[model samples]
Target: MFLLKTLTILVAIVVIIGAVTLASKKAVHHDGLEIEDLNKRYRMMANAVKQAVMKKEAWKKEAKAEKIRAKGDDRSDTKPIAFVIDFKGDLKASAAASLREEVSTVLEVARPDDKVVVRLENYGGVVHEHGLAASQLSRVRER
Candidate 1:
């Protein structure tokens, strides 16, 4: 019981400090977020790491990657898009409304080959809330 109380106090202090820090550092201008090309980011990071390798091995690795890329790219077709959405949930599942909107938008443009990727971060919650959240996802398949 004493240890629990101490932990609770420490957590409360951390929460207070975190809230203050976030309030002070919050974005003043709410310009929209940029869409990053993850594939490009991976390629750039790989190239940077390759530059640090021993010279002969780096050349060999680069050649192998290039060969695989060339073989994969020898097609004249559109690339399938992966739409990624994040869901941070609570007991009440308040975020489901926003999730519904995101799913609707993705469904509008999503082709059969395109993908809707959801990164769910919900600790187990009330049954009804989970059901609601699940139905929103079902809309994606219903389309």
Candidate 2:
């Protein structure tokens, strides 16, 4: 009887911890932005492609990439900066909170000509969660 009681208590404890973990996972994460240089990444990828291909083909690819890279790099006063943000939404849309922060951060530094690019990956999810996620994104235009 004592052993059975102890096992029951342990099971209860485990259940409580599991519930708390799930709740926290679904909660809004306050972690800040993860910034990356798209242009630098592109340059790195271009170099990789150039190295993989034959010399002549690599030159051709590099030439094309160079043109694209130049256009990206030569930012005049009037030219806009592209703020690219990637969001992978789960069923709970827990990432919506972080995305809100990202949009706000971009908006803070945004110029008149600046634009935002959100690469969202959401197959399907709870209706309310999706709606919340969409609202968070719409904040960009509303502001």
Candidate 3:
């Protein structure tokens, strides 16, 4: 029993050390979603909502309008853009790096009329880490 307990404790220590080492490493990535793709998704959702609210007979006329809208002809001027970023924060706010990258990308291409929306989920952990995350978000506003 003594030997078994010793081995278990050793294994646990090793696992904890490995986790800490990995957590200390910096890992950041950035990915941008195309405006066209977002528009497609918005149209799909709008279609679903329209289908739910309107009678089937009304669909034909709406569908024609949808086609024109889909063709990108409803506007004579530039349409405003929206940039969306998602961040999931943990005890260390490890996602802050990715958030920084995403914000940088948006700032590079976003116009004055463009908007940035960050969908954030945080466990509300260490003060320093959360502050870092908040600073990352503030970059968007500063731009």
**What TM-score, over all chains together, does every model reach?**
0.59, 0.59, 0.63
User: How much is 78 displaced in model 2, in angstroms?
Assistant: 3.9
| Backbone clashes counted, model 3 | 0
**For candidate 3, lDDT tens digit of each residue in 21-118?**
78776444335543446777877898899989999989878998878766886653478877888888898777777777778888998888889898
* Error at 111, model 3, angstroms: 1.6
Clashes of each: 0, 0, 0
The C-alpha stretches of model 2 lying farther than 4 A from their native spots are: 1-30, 54-77
Q: Which stretches of candidate 3 lie over 4 Å from their true place?
A: 1-36, 52-55, 72-77
List the candidate numbers ranked by lDDT, top first. 2, 3, 1
Candidate 1 residue lDDT tens string, 1-143: 99999999999999999999898888564433335777778977877687777597777888688779968975454778888888999988877777877787778888888887888999877888788789988887675
Instruction: Please tell me which model should have the higher lDDT, number 1 or number 3.
Output: 3
lDDT of 2 by residue, 18-58 (tens): 99999998996656677788878997896778767759776
Cα error, residue 108 of model 3, in Å, equals 1.1
Native-vs-model 1 lDDT? 0.80
